[model samples]
Every structure is written in C-alpha cells, then in structure tokens.
Target: MQCPRCHNLMVEQSFEDLRDDTGSLCFKGWRCITCGEVLDPLILSNRAAHREPMSGRARQKRSFIQIGS
Candidate 1:
C-alpha cells in the first residue's frame, strides 16, 4: 500500500489485542515509513460500508481486551 499523505510505500505489520465492548479481531496495521501514517486493516473494512476512506496516522491507539461472557 501507499501512504496517502506522502505517497511513500507502506509496510505491513501485525497488531494484537484489537477489541472493545463489541469484540474485535486479529488485525494488521500498515505504516508509512516516510510520513508516519498508520492504517488499520480491520477498521477500513468495517467503515467502508458507511464512511469514506480512512486516512492519516493512527489518531487513537486502540487495543483489544478479551470479553468474558
């Protein structure tokens, strides 16, 4: 992938513990080495149904917490 801001190539990386009150999934985060932009693969897919494309670095650092039923 390419960084939307700098147009630099992005590097793929794994991120663990991505969840909330609604549960989560093991996802990947892409980061642009040039502009420090981070994109969450999961969020992009989920929001694609309703929202516009996601952009820029990770504004909120999100992590998953196992939910106990």
Candidate 2:
C-alpha cells in the first residue's frame, strides 16, 4: 500500500499500543518507508476523530512551578 500523506511505498509492520491509547492489543499496520508514517486501523480511527496530536500541551491548562529564594 501507499501512504496517503507521503505517497510513498508502505511496508507491513507489527507493534503494540497502536496509537498510544490505553489498550492491550498488538496490531499489524503499514509504515511509510520515506516519511516514517504509521497507518493502522487504530491510528486511522484517531486520525479520523481529529484529536490533537500528542505534542506541545499534554494537558488542557497551563502548568507551572514557582521559584523562591
């Protein structure tokens, strides 16, 4: 299969925790050889849901620590 994003040839790969979700399932997926993109049933679901990527703000609100002397 070809990657939708990169248009590169995809190879079959297997891994656990398909999309970083709290599930105990191992899945078979396709990975882009050029862009390192992963495409699987689980990943596709999350992508379709349009959930925010797991970067930048992991939490909804800002967190900080105060420094004192």
Model 2: which residue pairs collide? none
lDDT of 2 by residue, 41-62 (tens): 8778887898676665554333
Whole-model lDDT per candidate:
0.72, 0.78
State residue 65's C-alpha deviation in candidate 2, in Å. 30
TM-score of every candidate relative to the true structure? 0.52, 0.52
lDDT of 2 at 62: 38
The list of candidate 1 runs beyond 4 A from truth reads: 18-25, 52-69
Error of 1 at 17 (Å): 2.4
lDDT (Cα, 0-100) at 35 in candidate 2: 93
Each model's number of backbone clashes?
Answer: 3, 0
- Which portions of model 2 show Cα errors greater than 4 Å? 18-24, 46-69
